[model samples]
Structure formats: structure tokens, C-alpha cells
Target: MKGHYRKRGANTWAIVVELPADPVTGKRRQKWTSIKGTEKDAQVALRRQLHDLDTGKLSHAEKLTVKRYLEQWLDSKARSSISPRTHARYREICEKHISPAIGKIRLDKLRPLDVQRLVDSLPDKGLSRRTVLHVFRVFHNALERAVRLQLLSVNPASAVEPSKPDQADIAVVDSAGAAKLMDEVVGTRLEVPVALALGAGLRRSEILGLRWGDVDFDDGRATIRQTCQLVKVEEPSAATAKKKTPRFELRFLTTKTHRSRRSVTLPPSVVGLLRRSKASQSERRLLLGAGWQDNDLVVERGDGKPVRPDTLTKQFHKVSDRLGLGVTFHGLRHSHASLLLKGGVSMKAISERLGHVSASFTADVYTHLGRGIEEQAAEAFDRVVKHER
Candidate 1:
């Protein structure tokens, strides 16, 4: 038997477990322990030891620390599992939050109370409630992997209560504010970007990643193929740091999700505006001649390089603030959904338009906008009664 227990006294029992043969000596190995409890307790102890031996966790448990294991997990994840931005965020959470808290503890010795203490202490570290929750999730996910790999019998994080962050309000621009925004950007560089955002509801990265070839002027359509990301450049080792390197680099990545890779029909006004933008870009290309760098990007610098996504967000905020709109660039996307919701559009339609994963998620986000729909429903009922009369 792999394990067995025998009663030794009125309240004591002896447990014996068979372990794998010693590698060097090729001799069978066994373990024996005494339990000062009932026969059931001795049986449990015997079974636990057998399971640990089968999983091989007993060998690594004493040597592996939380910080070392997490670093190794991140290195494996960096290969192909997650996007570069997500990997960077995960690493930041590991190094800045998790490691500082419980990283020194042996992985096998980690307990639910230890995890709870880490969660409780994060707010004192000046982290926001949302960020604290994120750290908890990352740590929980790592521990879950450990359980699946037979490194742990259970995930300690599963027993800890997660921090609940207050939901922040979603800001949206009213129709009048959207009109004013369009009017203000008429002759400025913000024209096309603003048009795509307020007019068609593209994310800032998607707007910056748009290429001329992705647009169809005649069909009034644009395909979302890629997105731009500003990723932090990894610090080089001492030898490589001698060479100068930029702090950040812009990269073109695929869409955020399968749903995010979608086609959006442009409003006619946006199409017309884009036509003008194309003409203007052509003139600039001619002026630069051979010096022009043609990256085929629809929105770019005069020399034909992609616009940094943050620069677009800052410029958009500047205009919105000047106009007293109080709306951020992303707020414009919320405004787009608000405007559509007010026009009797269904939540499912808006979800598909915005490339959200599900209509229910879209409805939850724009639930505040449902008052207008309720009002419209009441008006429709009154009209039916009047027609019957």
C-alpha cells in the first residue's frame, strides 16, 4: 500500500507512507510518523504524505520562495502567452507590490492569512483600491498556476476576501458639447482624430493605428486591423546600458480582443473630413519629396511617422477643457454610445458597433443612459392610447 495507519493506543495511531526509491542507491524509501489523535487523523496524515510524494512537491517546497517562483512564472509567460503591455503590468505588480509583501516566504508555507495581510496592507502603501484589487488578482492567478502544477495543495488566495473598489463615474459629452467639439477642431490637427472618436467611437490607439489602406471612402467604412501601444523599454544589463536607449518605444499590436477586430461604418461627414485629410497629407508628402517617410499611416506627423497615442489624448483633453466640455478623450467614446442610445439604438447594436465582448457588458456600462429610453417608452405608450381614443 502507498500509505496505511494502525492504532497504537487508546487515542494514538502510527502512519506509514511509501516513497519513491532513492535515486543513487536504488533502494526503497518509506516515511513513518505518529499521530496523537483518532485513527481517521492518522489515515489523513498517511494520505497527505503519499500525495506530496507522488506530486514531487515535497522536494521543491523547501527551496522555492514566492519571489523566485513568480519571477520564473513571468519569464515563461513573456514568451507568447500575454501581450507586451500586459506582461509589463504583471511584472510591475510582482516587483512593486507582491514581492515586497510575501515574496520572502517559502511557497509551500504560504497561508491564506498571509495573503489577507498583504491585501489589507496595500492601501497603507498608497495604492488605490482598484490597484490593490489588481494586485490581489495577479497574485491569486499565480497561486492558481501553482496548484495546477502540483506545487501547492491549495491556493491560499482563494481563502482571502478580495478588496472591493468603488465604481468610478463614466463621463460623457452631451450632443451640444460634441457639436461644439467638432466646430472647435474644424481647421486644427485634432479634426480627423476628433471626428473618428466622437463621430465613429474609435479608441485612441485604434485611431492612431489607422492606415490609408484600411479606409474605403466610397463605402464609408474603416477596418480596425491594429492598435498602437507605448511600451516601456526594458532596462538593459550593465553592459548594454552603456549604449543610449529611449525610455519608451511605440509598437503596433493586434486588436485587444477578437471582438475588437471589427469594421465600423463611418458617418458621411467623417468620410468627407477624411477625404480632405488625405488631400492635405498628399500636399505635405510632395513638399517633403525624397525626405518624406511614407508609413502608409492615415494619421501621422508631417514627415509620415505615426502619432504617439498619448499625444493625441493630451491634445484632445486640451481642446475639451478649453471648450468647458470637461470630457476626456475616452469620454468621447462614452458620449458616442450615449448619443446612439438616445437615438433609440439597442444596446446589442451599440455593443457590436463598439466591438464589446457582450451586449450585457455594454448595457451595464451605459445603464445610466437608460432614463432617456424609459422616457421614450412612456411617450410611445401615451401615443398608442391617444391613437386608440
Candidate 2:
């Protein structure tokens, strides 16, 4: 019920608290927690411990290892809160990066230096700065939950500074280059997807998740409401003796952001292409009769099953390489934005078409493509001034 602090050593204090009697032993119980700061800090620690005891929020035991604690944190707190893709990514980082380095260390005994060392060693392990930063964030978030639970006084990972990721160069092809790539993919299954990417600026997942119901051929627009992605599945261990399933499971999820679910007006050419593609699919469905999957997906295999995003990327890469375009599938999206910028379209319009969160974000991403427009603006200003004078 009451707690007090006593100096254990120079700058060290121990907080001792009395608890209710043990039911089995019929004897009083006590809890002692050591603090390593000033007198004020020791008093604060005592108050926190007494409050935890009063509220029954005290941690079970200090014997929990970092690995075990992280696992528990993910299952109990993270799994339901985060997106499935993010939860899986966090688990992968913890298992592959953090577990091997400091998993055996007790959670209460983890130090800032220990976390820093783990972060510092990531570069030597061939991880990029971005990946290292992601790993640190995941570990830091897990440790933060521990602090909130009163399992540790502070998050050790917070004291560690991971390397910052470098700004990646945005690669995009010009209209002519995009046309050349499209020419190469013409008459192929990738034609419609390439058209959608270059014309509507759809992400690969959005393109794959496109359904017939989402397209408005009459209005020349497409609504982006969902995205398809392949989530990696953890294989069962031998002890579980479960039957093996596919390594990855395909799932349809909400768009990357609420703003990402906006509608994009398709180009006339893209609309025409999609119309033809839809007619062909209808004919194939009738030919296959009851054997058809009838998923109504816009981009799918010969059957109605959705095409994997990876498969689309690979095919795009192969065609780009064959044409010497050197443009990624995402490059088509960049090209779409670049062409719109070059055509003097407003950033707000382009941003809305691309389903970007904001016009400023669209402008920032396409700033490099705006240099010519800046020059044109300067020339036009000079001409108007000279004519008026």
C-alpha cells in the first residue's frame, strides 16, 4: 500500500513497496525496484511502482527475454492494429534481424548500447539504410509498448540512431518512350495493364484488383477501391505436422490510403482498349461456359483468376528490357504524371487523377519534370512585358 526509496549507492536508489498478503502463505509480500538516477527520479520511480501495484498493472516478471517479449507484443498488440502486410513485415524484421542479435537478452536488462550495436551491425549484414531504419522502427515500437506496460523504465531502441535512407532517384520515361514500350506489349495480355498504368497512373496492386464493375466505359473513368497483394505465409514447423500450403496467399485489401480510392478518368485510347479487352473476356467466358471462374476481374489470367502483381512486374520488366526502355512498371505511372505536367495540367488535377493524398505531394514528386515549364513561364513573362512596353 505504501512505498519508500532508499539510497543503494552513489546516484542509485531502491524503491521498496508493501503489497497485500499472499493468499497461500498468509504472509505480507514486498516488491523492490532499483532506480539509477537522481533522488527526484527515485521518488518518481517509487510512485510509479506503488501506482502500478494499486492498479494491478505491474509486469508479471523481469525474466521475459527480448525475443519472447517481441513475439508477445506482436501477437497481443500489433497484429490487430496494423495492416496485414505491415504486421507480417514487422514479424519478418523481428525474426530475421533482431532475434538473432539480442533475442536472448532479458527485456528488463536491455540497454541502449545493445540496441545501437544491433542497428550498427545491420549495414555489415548487407541491409540498406531504409531496411535498417525499418527494422529499428519495428524494434523501437515493440520496446515502446514494453515501457507503457511498465516492463522497462525506457525503450532502449529509442536511444539508438539508425542511418537515414537516401533520397532515391525517380526514373521515368517520356511519352515517346512509353509509346515504344506500349508498342512492344501490344497484342499481348499485358496490353491492357500497360495502358492502364501509363494512361491512368494506377499502381500494380490497384490494376490487379480492378473489377469489371469498377470501370465506366461510358464515362471513360475507373474507380479504384481495392488492391490485390500476395502475403507471405509462414510454413508450419515439423512439430506442428500441418499440411503444406502455398507459400503466398493472394488477398484483396482496401486501397493504400483513403485518398487512393478516388476515381481516375481514363484516356480515350485506354478506354477503347479496355472495351476491347472486356469484349474478348466475355467471348472467352461464353466459350468456357461453366468452367469459367467468373471473377469479373479486369486484369486476370486466361481464366478468371487474378494475375499476381509480381507476375505483372516480371512481364513488364521483360518487355521493357526487350525494348531497351529501362523503365520499371512503376515508371509508367511516373510517365503519366510527367506527361500531364509537361502538358501544363494543373498539379491539383493530376494529383486527383493519380489519387495522391495532396497536390503538394504530386508537385514534389514531379518537380524535376517542371523545369521546362519554368523556362516557358519566364519566356512568356518577358514577351508580355516587351509587348506592353
Candidate 3:
């Protein structure tokens, strides 16, 4: 009967431990340890918890629902350490889908089919595949945390089929198209960050996060160190539109992957473009006076605030529409990868330059370009054999 566990509720099992409470307040809080399973399973859990207590891993039980725990996870696990944009994404998924369905479920009772049901409801609820998948990831992450905290023994979301949309072809504005885009950028109101996207194939954030110090004009090299994210903060008061400051402020942080923090050599033309851009940014500093917030190098307005990464994308789209061109800003990044592959650069080299986490990832994304280059190589071998014979 020692270390005997009692079924508290649902899938939750616990061992009751009595502790003195405040007699004045008449609040005698029940001290219970969380476990998940039958009596036999509880014995093993009891040993683990006692072992954890001996080793300093056992903590208090919170009868927290999936919804409450998710909020705690986001605030503690995400908002405390991660980028603002990332927190926004986690919060959005929790609100739009996960919170609505299984958020009320106890953390211990979450099942694989429960996760599947969440994904299955998306289409009927008019949510996109991408949104549904994001929600799934959030739910998976929550369950993963529960396992980490020893609240649950398994991750249910891992067992379920993920909602993957019919993927559209990888977009690329080919070499000639890229050149056209760059030329148009030069003539338009688009800034240097915009130019960098088309010319160098830098992502919008990478371009906007670039500091003057990161740019090495003499060596034509640039180092990626940080990303600028729009952190969302609650606005307490209704202020005048003109007087309203940003509810979301830019916070500089590291790249998503370690490889993303890389140094790349820019072409001479791109270097010149950056130099001009730098001078323009300097002029803005003088105009903004005390209003400017400087973080160096990233192409921000004269006021020193970094531009939202998507602002460049929206601008690029507008320009493309004006020029009667059909292209996404991301197409420029794809084009860069294609050009590298076509030039016979090894996937590893291309992966590093593009900040890809793995060479396999590079190979997967640019498979079409690699296939074309491989075909050309085969044709070259055939030509050489016939000529030699």
C-alpha cells in the first residue's frame, strides 16, 4: 500500500500528501503529485517522482487545462526568450484553432485522435491548410512540453497525420527576370533593401536586419548577425493617429539557424548599391534629429526604426504589378539558389551561402535546377564521347 496512487480524475493519477494550511483563512490546499495511468503505471511514476524529488526534479502539480498551460508555455517558454514575431505566431495559432477545440481538455487526457480532430476540423471551419498545420505544430509543441514536465508520458500530436496543403511550385524569378526586377528597383521608390532582395537573394528580414557595420564595402562581404522582428505589445490607451507610437517595436535577434549567421561576398554592383543606400540613410539621421533610433546598417527610415520585413515584399509586389510582372519577393531567393546550382556550386556551398540548415534541404528546394544542370552535364559527356570516337 506504500506509494499507492489514487485516480484523481480522467487520466490523472495522484498520491495525496497532507500538509498544514492557514487556520485563519480556512484554506487547506490539497498537496497532490501528478501522474498519468493505471495503478501499476502509477507505481513506476511514484518511484520516478520520489527519485526526482531526491534529485530535485519533482515540483507542484497544477490542474492546468491545455489552454491554460499553453498560455503559460507561450509566456514563459516563448515570450520570455523568443522573438516577438514568433510569440505572435504561437499566440495566433492557440487563439484561432487549438484554444477553441481542445484547449478545455485536461493536459493529462489529450489523445492522438483529439489532435487529429483538430486538424480535421480546419477545412470545415474555413481555415487554410497552412493555418491548420501551424495549429497542429502548436498543439504538438504543447504536448511535447507536458512530456518534458512529466505531466504526460507521450506526445499525441506526433502520432497523427499532419495537415500539409498541396504545395505550389517553388517560385523563382529567373536570372533575366531578376535583372529586370533590379533595374526596376533602381528606377522606382524602392530602397536598397529592396534591391538586395532581387540582386543578392537576401530574405526581407535579412536585408532589413543588415547593419552598416555588417557590410564590408572594401571586401564586398556582409555578415548576417541578427533579425529585426516586430514585437507586439498591448497599447493601453487610445491615442491620436499621428501621435501613436508603434504597438509593435523592432527587436534585433539572432538568425533562426546558426548557419544563417554567415558572411557572404557581394558583387561589385551590389556593393555600390549598398554604399549609395548607406549615404541616403545617413542623410535621414540628420533630418530625424532626436527622433531617430539607430541600430546601424539595416535600411530603416531616417527615423532609425527598422522597416517591417513584409513591407519590402508588399512594395515589391506593387512595383511588379505596375511593371506588368508576376513575381513574389521570395522568388528572388529561389532564383539565387537556382543560379548557384546552375553554376555547378556544390549543394553544401550553396546551403551555407543561403543559410540553409542542411545540404539535403538545399538539394530538396532546388531539385529542379539541380536536375537541369545534371541533364546538361550528361549531354556534355555524350558530346565528348562522340567527338573522341
Candidate 4:
């Protein structure tokens, strides 16, 4: 419905019409085409474009730059459909990886070779295979949307195969190592959070999001219904030239996946630890009196404010370095899973306990831990045959 005519050369005129805003970039979209002759010809062309736009036929005339189209596509289509974190990640990928490479190419003229060249160049730029795969996925998904929108005849990204990432090596601590680490952290602020990660296999975000209400002391269980994490916010355009650092704010979001919202039975040791943590918090609240923020979070700062996930990670790293533990905070969760697997826990049970989408995924991730189980199974089979003989 938005159209206009402007003088071009002596006898030529240009017709311009505003289209839907780019979904990715959140920028305005405009289509411009030239017509030879007088003002009458320009007005006629403008009317036709307006009519086409109104009837959804203007897609045929789209001559958008790849950068422009990606911006528009992400803003209009992807913003509402995806999580804020995922949307931000897609935007980062587009800006950092895709835009610098082939963004100026005409959307209609983009070729598979162009995409392949970009993918081939990523490794030379020092990106890992996993990160390169993520970049490819974002680009591929955007192109798929473009095809659906009739912006492209075919998705060029579909012709370029993304490289598969190598299997990740997981580091886990033994029972003795975990016990020593726990003893070192005794009576420290990290005690409860570390216990949750090592004993209950809770993710860092899940531990931060836990509240007193989520814990059932009588039932000896805890429910993971939400997660808290700090997400980076885009800086204002006016502040960009000042080199202002990006800001991050704590946000409480739904569990990572549908299966992530599950219940975990608490071990008696963890229960006792939680009880002691609660008593310590109660003493602090009494001392602070009216100054206390009372957020009821199981893991929080002294003022009851949410603990920043990054801060927790840094502190854990410092403690691990001092103790020479040689394990990350996530290693605690890996240790918990490894211990459970070694104790003969069923794969399905472990998957559910870890809130995995499927037991197969759990088994795949813990394949190294399952080797001992194979030996145990073989031993049991031998015993059965010997008894029968």
C-alpha cells in the first residue's frame, strides 16, 4: 500500500514501494524500479506495484540484497517464533559470519559456490568445526525461510554440506576426588550449589533458579521447573561509537527442554546439606533484618539476589585451580552421571534423572562410562552358564 514516484533522468522516473520490514534485522524494506517516459508512466508503474503488494504478488519483483533480506526476514519472522537467546545467537551469526562474507550479493543471484566458499573459509578464520556447523545452520535456516517466502527459487545453502563435529571428550572426577573437593568447599558459599551439581546432577542454570518452594523436604525431592542465566543485551546505537561494553541481565526462563522440567529425588546427604544452608541463610536474614531481599532462592547472594552464572563459574574455576582438582563445574555433573552408570543404573532411569529428551542421547553421551557395564553384563552371563552346568 506504500508507493511513490520520483524523477530519475530527464525522461525517466523511478517507482518506489515500501514492503514488509526485514524480519532478521528489523529494518524497513523498499522496492524500487525505473520506468522510461514522463510522470504519467512513473505513476502508472507505482500503481501497479502498490496493487501487486496488496495482492501478495510483489515477491516476484524482489531484488533485495542478501544482507537486507536476511535482516528483514529475521525481524519479521524469526523474532517471535524463537527464544530471545536463540534469536540473539542467530543475529550474531548473521552479523559476524554471514554478513561479512556474501551479504552484498543479490538474494536472487546467490549461488551454492558462494556459500561453500564461506564455509571453507571459516576454518582458516580460526573457528572450530562445531562453531562452523552452528554458523551453517543459522544461514541454512534463514535461506529455507527465504524459499518459503518466495524470495529464492531454491535454497543455495541446501547444496552445501556442513561439516560434522568430532565427538567431545568428557572429563569426570572420581568419588575420592569429589569428596576431597567437597571437604575443601565445606562451610563456603559454594557448598550448596556444588552439592546440587555433584549429587543431583543439576545444571548451573537449574541450580541458580532453584527456590525453597521447589524443594520438598518431606518427600526428599526437588523439581526443576525453570532456569536462570545472564544473557547479553544489545547496546544502543548511540552508545556503539563510544565502545561501550555490552550489558547482561539475569533472566528466568523455562527449562532448557520440555523434558528438563522433571523431578529429582534428593539423597539424604544433599538433604542435610540443604537444611544446613537454609539455617545459615536464616541467620543472615535475621542479621540483615529490613535490608534483606528475601527472594527465597536456594542459591543466591548474601542479599538474596540471584547469583550470576558467570560469577559462579569463575569462582568454581578459582577454587579448582587452588585445589588442583583439574575439573570444571560441569565436570561435577559428569561425575554424578558416571557414578550412577557405574553403579548399574538403567540408561532410561539415568536419562530421566538428567532430563534428557531420550535414553539414546544419554547413552551416546556416556558411552565411555558404559564400558564397565558391558564387562559386568558379560560376567553375569558367565555366572548363569556356570550355574546351569
TM-score of each: 0.81, 0.76, 0.77, 0.77
Question: Could you tell me which residue pairs clash in candidate 2?
Answer: none
lDDT of 3 by residue, 1-389 (tens): 12447888887888754322322233554446787777787788777655654442443223557787777777665646556677778888887778888889876577788888888988798988877777787778767766765556567788998757665577676677767777777735465765676556677778878898898899999898887766777554566544534476767778877788899888788898778777777887898888888778557755777777667678878977886667677777777878777778899988888888899988877777787899999999999999999
Residue 99 in model 4: shift from native, Å? 1.5
Mind giving the per-residue lDDT tens digits that candidate 1 earns over 201-274?
Answer: 89988888899999998889999988888987766656687674547888888887888989999999999999
User: What's the lDDT for candidate 2?
Assistant: 0.84
Give the lDDT ranking, best first.
4, 1, 2, 3
Candidate 1 stretches with Cα past 4 Å from truth are 1-48, 52-62, 237-246, 375-389
Cα RMSD to the true fold for all candidates? 5.8, 6.4, 6.8, 5.9
lDDT of each: 0.84, 0.84, 0.73, 0.85
In the range 73-131, model 4's lDDT, one tens digit per residue, is 67864536445677778888888899899989888788999999999999999999999
Backbone collisions counted per model: 0, 0, 3, 12
**TM-score between model 1 and native:** 0.81
Candidate 1 local Cα displacement, residue 86, angstroms:
2.0
- Higher-ranked by TM-score: 2 or 4: 4
Location of the lowest summed lDDT over 10 successive residues in candidate 2? 19-28
Please list the residue runs of candidate 4 whose C-alpha ends up more than 4 Å from where it truly belongs after superposition: 1-61, 76-78, 81-83, 150-154, 237-245, 379-389
Backbone clash total, candidate 4: 12
